[model samples]
Target: MPYLLLIFVVLFYAGNILTGKAMNDLPPFTIAFFRLLVAFIFLLPIGIKSAWKARNTFREYKGPFLIMTLTGVTFFNTFIYGALQFTTASNVSVLETVIPVVTVVLSALIVKEKLPLIKWTGVALSFLGAVWVVMDGRLLELFSSSWNVGDVIMIGAISCWAIYSIVVKQYMHLFPAYGVLLVMTGMSVLILLPFVAVEWTIGSVPSLGEVKYWIGFLYLGVFPSVIALVFYNRAVERLGASQASVFLNFLPVVTMIGAYVWLGETIKLPEIAGAFIVIAGVILTTRAGTRKKRKSLNYKKTSYN
Candidate 1:
């Protein structure tokens, strides 16, 4: 069932790609705000009790919690919705998989995490693959083709994801996943409110009366925002983040099929090849590492002092 849950996590993540495509008319900030607000409303009942019980958790780890919530819940989706305004879902999925590479590189520089030669090689390969996809497989396009705003925006989103993942690993012990999610969801809603207000002023926010927009909004609010988090927390509990992320390699493939089916997106060979290359690099980076005893990341350490 762990394997199945991993697949479910990927599916729900793929749903985000579809959701973004479906809400093309809505302002990115508006969509992001609504998605978080709806998800926060639903998730509060499930996790708020834990958060209340652990109310001091916030006081203790205020800095980390603030940073985590801002990066993961706030800025990440902000850029994702922004990116969808200009690029294809296939490109988004393929590019987003580079999160690990971004994390690894950042860790190395920020925290001085050392990487073996093989992992370094993987990093290089993954970057090249990302460039290949961004340029539609031809390096010459780097010079000839104008860069897509969506692609550039997605890099910002991916960077936020990377930072969030690192912060989670460092401080996940402070609260249960549910409790942590509750806090983050609330923070995201609050942080996004001002932006939503601005979008409303600009008249870019879409009306909620449209059925298609409701479907897209509801799906994102529920599936990716709520369901994916539960499944991912469970997977991380069973398989450590490094092992769990291997399953994320299937993300692009799933997104490709989902994009084709839901968004009527056409896949290109270069995009496919680039995705494969990126996944291959990820596998090399993660799989080549030294082995350790099987220890689940229960992350139940008491709140920090």
Candidate 2:
């Protein structure tokens, strides 16, 4: 179930980049504001009902709410949209491949996550493969051409997602994903409102009347903002954030396909090779970790008996 959700999330997020690639007319914060506002509206009724039922639980975990608001709502998309204005979506997607590693490492540091050696090696290999594609067979060029301003900002954005996923994992069952989405979207709207206002003052507002902008706007609100998060949060619930994050390593594959279809970009051989390598690493790490976990669980049960 969660795997299916991640597939939908991958496709929706591909659209996020595709739309963001061409949303030069809108300020990043402003676009985030609109996206969250529309999402909040769409989820209001159902979300309100669910949240109402969970009011006491929501209050009990205000800390999680705040963390979710900050990480998921606060600036992830703002930073991503900001980066998209300055780099190709494909390039941005390449940069995003670092996120699963970020999530894993952060989970280790922040949550004391432990993994087998093979899984760790898989993580490292996946990163090398992503860098392989980004550097186009010249690994040395990675050091030389790695940190454009946009790519650096994107790092910050994906970091936000990493943190958000960690928090989501912590509260996977404690907080309902639906209510979390509502509250996070609502908080994000509040958070980005002033920033969007600043952009509006600076003549950086989007053309709300433009049909193309509307299409992007609606797609973002409906698909990535609302639907994707539901799927993503559920994946976090079922798989744990660190495991769910491995799925994100596949983003570039979806982005590459979407880019070709929507933006008429051509796929490259390096990207294909990198995509396969990343998938290989994801499979190795996840499968090995699961097997180890099952072994441990069986040992514990036998000892108890």
Candidate 3:
């Protein structure tokens, strides 16, 4: 599981690098559209087979399935990609680390999940770490022109993702994960088609001359979007959402590495420190949740057996 998660982190960083490269050639939405489009093409066969096998289940979940696809694939990806246009990869990645915090708060409010004190502390620490990283340790710079519109867009994107995560956790028990992903990918592709068409009409279509662009597209479609998601769902199924969220703490580190190698971007000391704090907080939060889950399981077993 650790090895799989490590690979997921690597791919996640690769996706960030790829987005950085592609954002130059195309608008964020167009780039996102194509990324999903490629994944849709690759998974269409499997999705079709799965849909056929689970036709009855799909019929029963038409409404929920639609909502899940819209939120997860369409809204989340579109917003993130668009936000990338205005933000630095480092800023975006660090901010994204707060997604679990958003998810936790939303879960508490919407699903009535109670957070332990330790976990709440961890969440607070993680959020502070994210802020530090976003500000690059120059606390005062946060309010300066050094911050751009992209940062604001990223916050909005994070909110969309947090909402999407909660919605999936709420509805996934009703349908298979792959089935839901397949449907969502398909629907997202359809939603973006007209946008892609408009972009093509307005200007010449983006070319694939640069090797980096193709590499980025392939990495985004196959790894982060497709393969990483498979691993994520499996991890969530086995470990539960609260536990699985800790792994996302690794995302910023991986992204930083990718940025350095692929984009030749330099990382400052504060960024490194912030990443560590975020990871520590994530660990604490997950450990707290695990203990809670065990106690609940023990209570249920005592009552039933």
Candidate 4:
């Protein structure tokens, strides 16, 4: 059942890529601002009650909350949307599979969490696969070929997400999940508002009259922002973060299929092979982490008894 919910989560996230590409006419900041604004509005009614109940938690953890909102809500999708402007959706999706691996690395560096040898191996594999895809399998042309700016931007996107994931794992359990998300989304909307105004001054404002743009915004706001996140939080509670994130290995597959079917984008050999490698690496890394966690739990239980 948790797996089923996670599947839907990835599906919704994949739709984010499709819709982001389709809505490329809109400025990235504009899309991010309004999409989050819509989500904030949609979540306000339910989240408000829980938020009030947990007001003390919010007040106590303002720093963590601010970090969560800035990295996860504000910067993540905006980076994705910005990357979408310069890269193929398939490329972006493939690169995004690096998140779990990157998160593990960050966990080790920032939190001083020790990674097992197998986990490090998995990280190396994932990194290699990501670079392979970015280079379009032409590793021989390493220094000579021009890289896609959007693909480079994806690195920042993944880094923001990696930081966000760590913060969530460390602190999100202290607050009501939906309530926290509501506050975060609202914060993101506010943070992006000034940027959107600046963007408008540069003639990057979206056309408000287009039905298609609204449809895209609705999909982005409702599915990826709200529903996927809600379902993902539940899945994480049920399955544990490592186990649940293992399912994201399929995200690239879903996105690539959507890209081919909807946008008529071609999936090249390098991308397919690199995606396979990345999936393998993510599975290895996440499974290794989960096993380590289980071992630690058993050790504590033994010591307690």
Model 4 C-alpha lDDT per residue in residues 1-305, reported as the tens digit of each score: 77679889889998998899888878899999889988998889989989889999999999998887888789999999999999877678767877767776677788776667886777667666765765678878756756699989999888887777777777878889789889889888888988999999988556689888888888888889988877876766655444455566577777777877887878789878877886777667767766876998999999999
Model 1, position 43: C-alpha lDDT score:
83
Give stretches of model 3 more than 4 Å off: 1-14, 21-23, 145-147, 209-211, 238-243, 297-305
Q: Write down the RMSD of all candidates, one decimal each.
A: 5.6, 2.0, 2.9, 3.1
Q: Which portions of model 1 miss their true places by more than 4 Å?
A: 1-7, 126-136, 231-250, 265-279, 290-305
Please give, for residues 164-230, the per-residue lDDT of candidate 3 as tens digits.
6666666666665566567678778888888888878887787758777666777677666777766
TM-score of every prediction relative to native: 0.82, 0.92, 0.86, 0.85
**What's the distance in Å from true for residue 236, model 4?**
5.5
Question: What are the per-residue Cα lDDT tens digits for candidate 1 across 1-305?
Answer: 55578779888888887778778778899889888888888888888889888878788999988988888788888898999899877678767767766767676777575666786676667666766754568877667756699989998988787777666666766787687788788889988898889888877546689888777778888888878877766655554454455455566777777767866778789878977886776567555553322121223333331
Give the clash count for each candidate: 0, 0, 0, 0
> lDDT of each prediction vs. the true structure?
0.74, 0.81, 0.70, 0.80
Please report the candidate that would top lDDT against the real structure. Answer: 2
lDDT of 2 by residue, 119-163 (tens): 787877777776676566677877777466788789888889999
TM-score of 3: 0.86
For candidate 3, the 10 contiguous residues with the lowest summed lDDT are 2-11
